[model samples]
Target: MWKTMILLVLVNVINGQCSCSKFTDESSCFAYGYCLFVNGVCVEQKCEAIPYQEKCKSPLCLWKDNKCLTFKAAESTCQTLLPQQCTEYQGCYYDYTNLKCQISNNCSKLEIDQCNGQLGNGNSCIVDPFNNKCQEMTDCKSLSTEFMCLSQFPFCLYQNSSCKPSSCNEINDSVSCSIMDQCQWNNNKCEIKNCQSIKFGYQCNGKTCGFDKDQCFSCIEQYGYQFFAGLISLLFIL
Candidate 1:
């Protein structure tokens, strides 16, 4: 009888040790240090088992509400960050003067080196001849001179003494795309190329691309075609 009682106790202990999913109550789940109550179910905890927020440090996890949660880049935005936490997230900048975390839209405030950082969002900095200040360029039609239009080549084209929007496929020559800022000659067609494709440091033009440790890199890759369309719409509104 004692042997049977001992066998039953051993079986119960083994079952309790392995039965995290059987826990239906939050209190019971919390009692187990290795178990987590998530989405109305109890499961084995990994990063969530971290007791302190400061102790939670992993690229895959983010600390929130004193708990370590999975990091999801798509769910995050630049607007919902504190000034101190702004620069820590990708594609976010902290403006000291305004005391805000935001994606910078005003190209005029940026220096020459910082100008093309906004290129991914359909904004570029150009020297305004009238004011002699670096200003944002959103519309090719705003460019008064051919020299100004050609300088923004691939994005803007000079034709009929006027500047107009130029797509990558519009350029037929390989040489023209090779020398231009944002274009690459690939498969006998002019195509948009990111900074990573550039092999040499000399090929990294500070305008649309940057160089670091003999490799070319872009400032930001968050913005896409939607941003360009929005920029054109904004230009028409202005």
Candidate 2:
């Protein structure tokens, strides 16, 4: 029985040393068959377990950018408010290879403000994407909201924010007269009047403004005459 026990122990030791192994490169037969050695001969017993990244998702796109990515690198490109927390947005996909936001087509842009000329032009549905103050523009020049696209592909502006000049030449368009002031439309020829506008200086009371040179000169002359008369009166008294 003692001899049987010793034989079993011996078998285990030998099996540990000759265990079947697997590796990446089959061309290198030296690492294939034999078990990996801690202090023994160099061989791989099994391939190392590769780490996997958690999946991310968004309402519009499910499972965006499933490629392996480092946390810092992924967070830099992706805007996950709760990186540590297992939130719903965590499933939104982020593609590290191209650094892009991928999501569902149903993802839509929310309205930040009612379309107004406040942006210095006129369109509608100017929106702030991702709660960021940055406003997406379709085309500031043409004011086309459709052209405005974001990196996340989740948010977009519905329309342009400002007014644009007409591209057609078919009909006469009334241009704003404030630009050139007095506008005259004669024979379809709009003529604008140019005036040498003047500005009033300070000391202008109510309706008037600027120094009265004529009034100032008269006051100076009166003071000089008073001084001369006072000198003559002193000489006569002496």
Candidate 3:
């Protein structure tokens, strides 16, 4: 029985399923088919094999370097290679440029004309779909919401007309709200808040307050007349 036990242990070691506690480095673990290197240790990870086409998705095409590689392939390669592989399909193409690999039509020329402007002015321009001509870009200040601004231009305006994403310690006003609906200016920074169905003259935050004017007035009175007098005057009418 002891000899049989010893043989089983030797077989397990030969199969590369032995514990990696003896090894300190990742390379030793990798040599045994362990894929995860974590917190100064190597461990076995469960990986499910998915189909190449579904795993790649759109703008992401599979290419053969040696094995199948899935990433954003070039327009020329995507349209040519993928179409030939499956005759039933209209063929796939990488949708975006830069780092992203999306499957869509080529809009590189149209985007270039819009950004640089066909007329060659420093002013940013975009294709006006109505006229099909490049038109000068509008400022975030001119637009009502951040979504409108970003939808039109690449960036949105800050409190000082500076273009940037809402970082720490920014004011959450109408302009900021338009940029991202989920964030609110709280404790000197943009924070996630529930501003939906906000009651008049009441600050919107995570918690819901009663819409009843009497209860609201009673709560406000505790803070003193000078603090909430204006708020009471506005919301008390309803």
The per-model lDDT (C-alpha) reads: 0.59, 0.29, 0.37
Residue 61 miss distance in model 3 (angstroms): 7.8
lDDT of 1 at 238: 49
TM-score of each: 0.31, 0.16, 0.25
Write model 3 residue lDDT over 1-238, tens digit each, in one string: 6555555443333222234343345554343332345677755443222223333222233434433343333344445453324211222322234422222322233443323221122233344444444344444454433443455432354445444544323544546543443345554556544333445433421112212321211112223355344444444453
Once superposed on the true structure, which residue ranges of model 1 sit more than 4 Å away at CA? 1-105, 110-114, 119-122, 129-131, 167-170, 175-238
Residues forming the 10-long window of minimal summed lDDT in candidate 1? 9-18
lDDT of 2: 0.29
TM-score of 1: 0.31
Top model by lDDT, which number?
1
Where in model 2 is the C-alpha error above 4 Å? 1-113, 117-142, 145-187, 191-193, 196-238
- RMSD (Å) of each candidate, 1 decimal: 22.0, 39.6, 23.4
**Tens digit per residue, CA lDDT, model 1, 32-116:** 4355677989776666666656535433345777777654333244455555655454334455566555565566775443333
Model 1, position 111, has a per-residue lDDT of 45
Kindly list the per-residue Cα lDDT of model 2 for residues 20-101, writing each as its tens digit: 2222233322322322334433443222211222222221122325543322213333354333221223223333354443
Q: Comparing 1 and 3 by lDDT, which wins?
A: 1
